[model samples]
Target: MANDDLIYKTATEISALFRKRKLSPVEYMAAVIARSEAAQKKINAFTFTHYDEAMDLAKQAEAKFMKRDGRVGVLEGLPIAVKDESWIAGKPTSYGSLTVGKGYVPDRTSPNNERILKAGAIVHARTATPEFSCASYTHSRLWGVTRNPWNRRYTPGGSSGGSGAALAAGMAPLATGSDIGGSIRIPAGASGVVGYKPPYGRNPDDPPFNLDPYCHTGPMARSIQDAILLQNVMCGPSPHDIASLRPKLRLPTEYKPIKGWKIAYSFDLGIYDVDAEVVANMKKALRVFKNLGATVEEVDLGWTRDAIDTGMRHLEHLFGTQLALTAKKHSKIMTTYARNFARKGAKSKASDFFKSMEGAVRMYDTFGPMLEKYDVFICPTNAAPAVKADFDENKDVVRINGKVSPLPKVLAWCMTTPFNTLSRCPVLAVPTGHASNDVPTSIQIIGRTYSDADVFRAGIAYETAIGGWYGSRKARPVL
Candidate 1:
């Protein structure tokens, strides 16, 4: 196989080849490390790497296959990139902030990362994120900018931007991503990969975040199957995360046809100014669903700018203030947006937090009823293909439909926050199409609360219909 073919193979493909001895795990790991090094020079996706340690793991994985024992895990021998925000035993987890945790290391592993390690996957690199995973674009005072592989001038989307960019650039076949406000899906949409934001507790998380329904840790991959492969390992009940769902859900590799299913699509979720390119691609995606035997209809979500306000305020209450207070001492080193978020969070009152909860109730009041009527909901993942690689979250204006909106509503660029408010719904961000700017765009396939399987079913059907973006070399990124 050509070198590009090796680098671009999905985890599923790699696993299959390993089983057949067509590709050795050691050989694949070397290719991955080499490709990752090259991609890093271009996009700055990974922050930390342990290629030497990863090679040893690959050798052990290769031995398992050589023994022909039935001891292999589903993801055995695949190279995976872990997001910098996740803890990995003794490794330093920056969480994308330079002000704190510069070289701080965790003695214990995060539940999700532990599961990935147990699945026999090789963790070769750690991807970048915005400081404290705060922004929608992936650039930070610590790790600089993580550019889109398709267009270096644009961002790959964040706080899972590094994971998304690494996958698109073939730095790794599978990676991890966390989504509070579209961190996973935003980068998936921007980088043209696949990101799955499973319903809260569907995939076990670590810490206070595990209890916060809006926060979740999930899978990012080049293909939906590879994503499923990783997600299965990462999900389940954990003693550390009391909120994890019981009777651990394991999705099947095969999905029932989506024929005769009803799908409701919203261009703007009732409010934000959407770009024509994003709308055009979403319309095309809807057509693909129609072609695949599902009925697509347009619906009004009745959402308002308050959704953005509520989300930001709630996040401020949860993580913003904590980060802000910490950055206050190191104010000189913090990014402008991080500092602003801190100030807003610091000044936010209890009433503001209560009102944000009210927004969640208000959203579910309408969305809960809408789900009963439609099998799933679809919408653009990001309003625009991407912000500039160095886009400033606080000062930049994202012009939509030829008009600039208010500064506070900037989160509106990503139509993902409202769903985070609804928390239990499973959202899968899949590639819809690419924009003229060459950056990729996507639509969110949202299922009823906790109906994780349904979103995957819809995603697989759509991905199959669209020929899976990374299936063709010409379709892959030039970098």
Candidate 2:
């Protein structure tokens, strides 16, 4: 296979090759490292690289495969890009901020990272994120802007922007991402990659935030199956996390067909002013489902902007409060967006937090029943194609369908926050098609609460119908 082909190969295919001795782990790792270095120059996706250490680990995996032993971990030789926010023992967990991350080192790896490491996936590099991961786009004082590989002028999306960009750029076959307000799906949509946001406790998370139902640590990859591969390792019960679910649910590599399924779609989710291109792509994607023998229909969620407001309030109460505390001592060093987010969070009252919880209960009253009727819900991931690579959420304005709006109304263009409010729904983000600028447009496949298998089954069918993304040299980003 060509070097480019090798670079874009899926994690499952790479693992199969390693087991058959058709490709050496070290060789694959070296190629991935080279691609990562090249992509880094173009997109600035990584915070830190461990090429040397990764090669050492890759050698060990190669040795294990050479021995033909059955002791190899499922992810034995694949290079996985870890988000900067995740902790690795004795390694810096930056959270994309220079304030608290400057000289800090953690003694224990996060549960998700520990599982990935145990599964034998090589952590070749740490992907970048917004300061404290407080924004929707990935640009910060610590790490520069992470651009979309398809179109560098646009953002890859955030706060898991780096992981999404890396997968799109073929920097790694798999990567880790944490979503607390659309972080994973935002980037996944913008970067045209597959991202899975498992139900809140489906995957283990570190303390404090793990307790926050809106928070989720999931998988991002070039393909749905590859996303599942990493997710299988990252999920399950963890002794350290009380929120981790019991009786682990492991998804099968293959899923039953989605034919005869009922799919419901919404263009704007009743609040967003979606771009024409996004709607066009969404319609085309729905046709794919229709062609597969699934019945597609439009639905009115009866959801209003209040859903977005409540989500922001909840995030401010939990995630933003943490940042507000950090900003008390390090305001000058924090990113403008992060500081602004902290300010809003600081102003939140206990009543506002309680109202947010009340709002969630109300929103779910409509959504929970809607899922009972439809096998899954589909909608545009973001109302617009994407913001600029260096988008400043504090001051920047987003234009969707030629209607410009300020930062306060920005969530009107982002449709993922409602799912975060629901918290238990499983969401899978998949590309629809690229817009005129070449930045990708995507849709979310949302399943019933904790029905993780439903979303994957739909995603697999949709992906197979679309022939899988980034499978050929021409399909990959030119960068």
The best candidate by lDDT is: 2
| Candidate 1 weakest ten by summed lDDT | 404-413
Q: Write the per-residue lDDT of candidate 1 for residues 103-125, one digit (tens) a residue.
A: 98999999988888888988899
Instruction: State the lDDT of candidate 2 residue by residue for 6-91, as single tens digits.
Output: 98989999999999999999999999999888889999999988899999999999899889457899999889999998899987
lDDT of each: 0.88, 0.89
Q: Least lDDT summed over 10 consecutive residues: which range in candidate 2? A: 405-414
What's model 2's lDDT at 182?
92
Q: Which regions of candidate 1 deviate over 4 angstroms?
A: 407-410
How accurate locally is residue 231 in candidate 2, as Cα lDDT from 0 to 100? 88
lDDT of 2: 0.89
| Clash number by candidate, in order | 0, 0
Model 1: how far residue 406 lies from native, Å:
2.2
